[model samples]
Target: MASFKKYRVDGGKFSLASIDPADSPFLEGDEQAQRDRLEQLAGELDDLQNLLHAEGRRKVLLVLQGMDTSGKDGTIRWVFSRTSPLGVRVTAFKAPNDDERARDYLWRCHANVPRSGEIMVWNRSHYEDVLVPWVEGWIDKAELRRRYAQIQDFERLLAETGTVVVKCMLHISKKVQRERLQARIDEPAKRWKFQRSDLDVRKKWAAYQHAYEQALAATSSRHAPWHVIPADSKRHRNLMIAQLLVKTLRGMELAVPPADPSLDGLVVV
Candidate 1:
């Protein structure tokens, strides 16, 4: 575990390109050692989740936003591998449906928030309101600014209500993304994950990167900050997010509820 001080973004001047996608600051071991550390962190997270459930006071929300092939699914698969589904839940947001489009953008997301004693991971989030629309020219500068302010306020509301939001922008290199996309096309086992529309979006890489930088700069707050994880290395990506999550949960100092004195001597037959 290392200090992630440099990676936290809080409405500051940020350049997505400034951070290398290949760098692994949080990683410090061989393949075997990395595996051991990740497993340890996963086990610790499961325990923390249990304590969170027992305490039953607050909740955690993990927001994963990334370009295609940034390993968002893989991160969730491995980071929470040791946890029970009873305590953890995941919601993956896709293109909005007609009902979702009829309401405010955050409506769908607000409905999926975590309950007390639970950790919720959002594969994509309200951020898409700003990102996709802005990238496609559907929203103007004025609209984008408004959306950002709305998002900040929305997150603040969640924080006021006892939600700890952890936002991670999984950063990956264009070269690596190309390789991953090609793998999906070439590898039969992964073909199901491939989307032809992905190539269409890939053409707007520069625009999307710019949009992300602006959105992150405008929306990242003290209550819900964003961390840019260099995801060129899949192992490091999983390790960093898992470690970040475990660390966040530990900071809550979760513990079981006080024992009831009346039942102190009770035992099952």
Candidate 2:
């Protein structure tokens, strides 16, 4: 398997345009085989998650950011299919409510951090504070830079507190997004997921892309690095994220806690 370093942004040096969303370097053989591999990865993720919950010491936070139709929900659905929900929490951030807007942008994010021995996934994260405001001309360049710094500091705090932060930007082509959006509009069963406001966002696609590039370049760091997953293929996206997560947890060297010597000879009544 190819190293995900090719997709990682480190030291603020990255070019989103250079990476093709259609590329699937990690895939082999036919589509069915790819599906099989993804299933295997999902099961591995389940086991790793179980171990994480058992160890009960550290936290894992997975942040997912992307364009409107970039498959954030789909990725979570497939990647965590086998993992128990008791140990995995999903937080989806939409347009901030009036109460949330009353406080600092990071307030809601801070409140959602994972607890020890659990995995928390943020569907849209604090990155939105940078992306939407910039694309809509709400925040000036200086404020944008300041927010980037604040984000880095916040992530550093998470790292210092024993949270393993893994961020991913789901990369998909505009044409693919259009097809998905259109499918949502055409299918009655999926129409509820479609929003008229999505069209407005599509009009500013280039602006949003530029905002994402800037945000990713500015915030990706060694402590909480960002990986851009090729998301034109849903299967490929799931496989890459699952593999990345499994690799991360494996690197943590998690194991069952040492058994109590005094209990070695004890038997249950």
Candidate 3:
């Protein structure tokens, strides 16, 4: 079993350096065992989601962050396909629109947060404000530091308000990302997903890696810690994420809503 340390809450950050990818016990399991576990976890997730919806006491926010072609969309599609769409919503955060730019950076994100009885997934979340902007020099160092502190406070507030936030950072090697991007370009149907900006970002791979390291270190807190999933293999990544999500949801201790008591003796002819 992999002994993972609980993320520190005082500094409001996660120490990614502490995690060893090779130590992930799930990766060593046989294919059949892995499949069985995945199925079991998926079923439990369905039950938990239904309970959450019916109880309507708390909300869940799943935030996925990764480099280009790191399989954020694929993870969402595969892991969440079986989930009830009515109780779940997905929001993909792209570059700021005019209205978004005019407001505070977190304004647009807050608007899309999950309400009680719903689960919301963020394809790229508020972390981008600190990650991308800081990496690409769009924001200065001082502002970047400020954003980290602000994000921590924001999440603390959300947690205090009955929101469960699960932040995941899909970690893929540079070579793997390159291969995935190439595959997209080679396959006609996937060509539309490829963008020139992707290559530009790829060129600064090291910068992004350092940026991620810093972001995770600064922002992983008890309220919203980052789960760094090894994403080189799509199947393994999906299974791990599913397991983690189900485990977290089950921890909430959700129960089905009770049947209405008003109907005592209604007889059908």
Residue ranges of candidate 3 with Cα displaced over 4 Å: 1-24, 258-269
Clashing pairs in 1: none
| Deviation of model 2 at 130, angstroms | 0.4
> Could you tally the backbone clashes for each prediction?
0, 0, 0
Tens digits of per-residue lDDT, candidate 1, 1-269, equal 58787778856688788889998987887889999999999999999999999999999999999999999999999999999999999999999999999999999999999999999999999998899999999989999999999999999999999999999999999999999999999999999999999999999999999999998889889999999999999998999999899889999999999998999889999
- lDDT of each structure? 0.94, 0.94, 0.82
Query: What TM-score fits each model?
Result: 0.97, 0.97, 0.90
lDDT of 3 by residue, 181-216 (tens): 999899999999989999999999888888888888
TM-score of 3: 0.90
Model 2 agreement with the true structure over 119-212: per-residue lDDT tens digits: 9999999999999999999989999999999999999999999999999999999999999999999999999999999999999999988888
| RMSD, one per candidate, in order | 1.1, 1.0, 2.6
